[model samples]
Target chain A: MTKVVLLGPQRHVPTVRSALDDLGVDGPVAVVTAGWEEREREVGELSEHLGCETRNLKLFSRSEKALDKDPELLDALRALNDRMRTLQEHYRLRLAHTMGAVRELVARRGAQEGALLEEEIEHALGAVHVLDQHHTRRTADALGTFDERYKPTERESIGRARGKVKRDLSPCAALLVAGGHVAVLATRLRLFVIDQLIEERPVVAWSAGAMAVTDQIVLFHDSPPQGRGFAEVLTDGMGLCPHLVALPHARHRLLLDDPSRVSVMARRFQPASCLALDERSRATWDGKRWTLGAGTRWLGPDGTLHEEAVPA
Target chain B: MSLAIHEFLANGTPTPEQIDAFLADRTIPIVEGPEVTFLYRGEAAEVSLQHWIYGLESSREFTRVEGTDLWWIVAEIPPKSRVEYKLGVIHADGRRELVRDALNDQLAHDPFGSNSVAAGEGYERPDWTLPDDDARPGTLEQRRIQSEALGQRREITVYLPARYRRSRRYPLLVVHDGPDYLVFSSLKTVLDNLIHRLEIPPMIVALTASNDRLHEYADDERHGRFIAEELVPAMEQRYPLVGRPDARCLMGASFGAVASLSTAWRHPGVFGRLLLQSGSFAFTDIGSSNPRGPLFEPVVRFMNAFREAPGKPAEKLFISCGTYESLIYENRSLVPRLQEAGMTVRYVEARDGHNWENWRDRLRAGLSWLFPGPLWMVYE
Candidate 1:
């Protein structure tokens, strides 16, 4: 188990330096900014914040080189991505309809058709749950097929990159993961199995980084540009920190004031705690239980934010 | 009845001193609820408000305050409405001139010039349209391509999203009237903000301008060939695009909208999405001659023919028009026809004029629906 410190978005009010200070991590820090994609190499500010020598692992660049060197692997990755996209579209189509029905039925729950409304709501909600599970399973299957067929880690190019990453990460006091495109970040990390290499090194990650370390990656937005954004499971995370759905930029991304939506989200991802990790919020995992920072809260089942810590 | 202007004229028509005091501290176009009182002060034989609000008189004479130079007119505008207008002043010397509002500095610009903007109650510019310090900006590179179809070299402005990588392939958005969109509509800033917020995916946007905008964009055969046969191939070669019809979008406003539709119609599956804003889709369902003038002859002919057999221009379309535009009927008519032809259409109508700002406000709705970002699903 790794000791992970998850913080909110660092764009506005940066709490990374303080988080690092609290952890007493002052030596050389290795940073994985794969999420920043093209800007992965620009880590001057982050390094300065740490006030220590930084080893930029450059996982994004390394992945690019590995894929470039191996055309077969690149083609496989592309094909897999295409399949995943189709699967997601299918999931979205069904989720939209199911969520609509649920919302309608829930709104009419107090009507004269009370028992019927409740029954229909349950059925619609059940369909939603099934759809999520099916999508998750299909995603895993597709990814598994690609991994099994290609054996990416065994490939010469990828193996070389992974070896270099492990060597680069060896001497760092702690790991710092900054946020950008979460999917890209997570994919690069998984390719090199950075989670495995981290071992017992304390990891201080924020935003998408915080999401990446969790057991599951749930994409949530109440008012997206398109239809009503019903929260959906994007993919399985690295599984470093368990039983937590890290919601970075919660206030901006979610409609916390709407109790119905909040209740659905909290209940949908049951057993796991939905942490609202807005700016200045922090949650520390000491490889056992969570120690939530002041003002840090989790979305309770009754649609309220509670200050109680969640057990891992 | 106690309007701010009424208060200014409470003690009969205001004297020069009282008028000076009234104009000193008060913001022009005094908006109180739905009533907007426009005021102009000058020596003129006649002063009229020339506005483009549909269902209202295009030109309304402002009443001269008795014994004073103040010309004032109170208009009942709905809340959240933004109106662009000019003052047509007929001088004492029998000369006439159209001028922007001297008292109101807020303006909306286009290719021709600019107009004074009067924002009604509850109207505020969307914060997302402005440049944000946090939103990392995309790069725009100007490139010239020799178009064999049009037999001319064309300048194209490409917008590469911030943190763009060669490793990742992006969707392609081809915009008609590129320079105008950048200068007038703030397209670059909008794209940057939307991408930063994950409201829309980070994609490559191609801004295409024409030498003869009216002729070329009015459903010219060569223009269609240039976009479909020449431009798409060149962009795909230079950049890493998804290279599928579904991943490509063609967008434009007014005549540019006609260009987008006709091009996509001509090349059936070239572009899978079309964003048509305030489309000048003038069609003669019954008549023989073009009533909108000689400039709209080609547009009318193309639109009429297309209405007969639209034949699925794209898989999805996001069409928007201002309720205050003459083309609203045509836009509203096109939606049903598109839906009937088995296309997913999202049509939005705003209570604004047929100006760049109206188009600007609708970009978020249009772009997001066509290519939604990873906010919902990022399967990585």
Candidate 2:
């Protein structure tokens, strides 16, 4: 049986524990986050509160210095910078000579000093013009060099992080919970684990995480006076369990004011089922049917439930 | 090749034909000057030199034996075409000196304080010293054990004011993009300097690392919960945290900026001060669809919710962005929206781009404005 649980935003650890216990899934869920250490520890405690196991699986960490400072890839960047400098110097000399001749002719003819001054001025101006053009071309070449160095290093980093998660997958039922930006990465990670490791793990996500498992992502950024909320159309999703669109924080007044907008969005996107879970609510998917659990209410268009048939 | 030509021209003496051959071969025409003029493709152009000297003086005398009138040389060249040549000057001592163009912008200052025509500005390389294993606040043994609980042991560097340990209690600031703040912005060093000068109040800064920074800094519950539930408790345990709403501040840039604001907006009791730089207040598609009640609308609603419910207004809110940043327009619009909602807002527009350079430059100003120092003293 497949089970889907929608937990509320900022729900107490006891509520999360009760939901997991009722599902009969055991301890030590793999926790993937990009939060600070103290935050990660609190998450660990939450797992402890629920009598479950927890593991950290984080991908990219921020660095204050340049990306090239990482010991693993610093030398290559330094070499590239060195080469870029050499090319620029070579061009500077070429431009100086091209402008020097004009400076001389104006001086030799016993001409007016004004005419000679203008010629010297033209020579200086010409030299600067050529140098600017050459500098722009060389800078583009330098950027390309940096890109060539970064690609492989990023892949290796992702591979090592994924390897740790795969090693932690247990023999029992597997449950994955992802939230916020982890949702987008989690979907990709889930696909990688399923495709390469040949594992069957049930996964769930909240907020951005939930949006990642669906067929598409609808961004809410409004530019300008309203906060920036731009909608995105995604082609790839985890597709672990098909046909349902999971909406977390459904009860957030900002999201739940009008059911018509959701229905219109649903129709335009065309998912088989639309499940809106508010804080402290659960929408369980047991393979065949999705049961909307207690905590919050889900209202469809026309002020009624949108389900084909309400689950017990 | 061009420099080689200039050096050849600078050689003390050359026959007129040698000079002519050089000019003609390069498709450059020579015009006698005082004022030499020409038309290139029908447009007139002119060139003139203010000074010119020819012929060397006697070996014992350091003077020009043959000098032309200062206005003697001038010529015309086509607009936008480049021309290069060198000057041959006979000094009073009968020696020649060749002067290259000194107007080159690419000239870099050398270590010995001389100017050199280098490709780019020669800068001293950054001496980046990784924190010593023991230099970190806690013990290495404890860090390793804590690392196991942390799952992935990414480095987290904290910033304490110079008088932090001596201070009875300090205000706390929880910020996202920890690594970037510490290293890129030199946040700790800035704080240290500021505190030493007594320019700003001594504060305990908890720089939290955001692994999946974008997702974690979204207007979602996970990020809010992480701060309110996990981050706060952990920091409070180790540090002498004031443990009051007004003393606690939250801050971040871009998406992290909005997350900080949202966290404080949602739970003003938990976070009272906000330093939002280039905040992403726009709506995103990942969360709920509340068309009538969009995220920004709710922020207004939340403000109203706070007002109608009657509570202390936020202690301080510092919002800022660079003038040239892409988010400038959006951020400008948000200021009035926040002000109208009754937030105690101090807005600043920086002249920069949307990167750490700008953020670092403004961190000191933002901090000082939010927490001003003692009244009487001025340090030079």
Taking the tens digit of each residue's C-alpha lDDT, what string does model 1 give over A170-223?
999889888777888888877887887998899998888898888788888888
lDDT of 2 at A127: 52
Off by over 4 Å in 1: A11-18, A26-173, A184-198, A255-273, A293-312, B1-26, B148-151, B165-167, B377-380
**Residues forming the 10-long window of minimal summed lDDT in candidate 1 chain B:** B371-380
TM-score of the candidate numbered 2?
A: 0.33
lDDT of 2: 0.49
Q: What DockQ would you assign to candidate 2?
A: 0.01
Which residue runs does candidate 2 get wrong by more than 4 Å? A1-6, A34-38, A58-157, A182-198, A221-225, A228-236, A253-255, A259-263, A272-274, A295-312, B1-380
**DockQ of every candidate structure:** 0.30, 0.01
RMSD (CA, angstroms), candidate 1? 4.5
The sequence of per-residue lDDT tens digits that candidate 1 reaches over residues B1-380 is 68998777777867898888888877888899999999899999999999999889999999999998899999988998999999999999999999999999899999899999999899899878999987999999999999988888999999999988887799999999988999999999999999988888899999999979899999999999999989999999999999999999999999999999999999998899999999999998886487789989999889989999999889999999999999999999999999998999999998898999999999999998999877653311
* Residue range with the least summed lDDT across 10 consecutive positions in model 2 chain B: B38-47
lDDT of each: 0.89, 0.49
Docking outcome class, model 2: incorrect
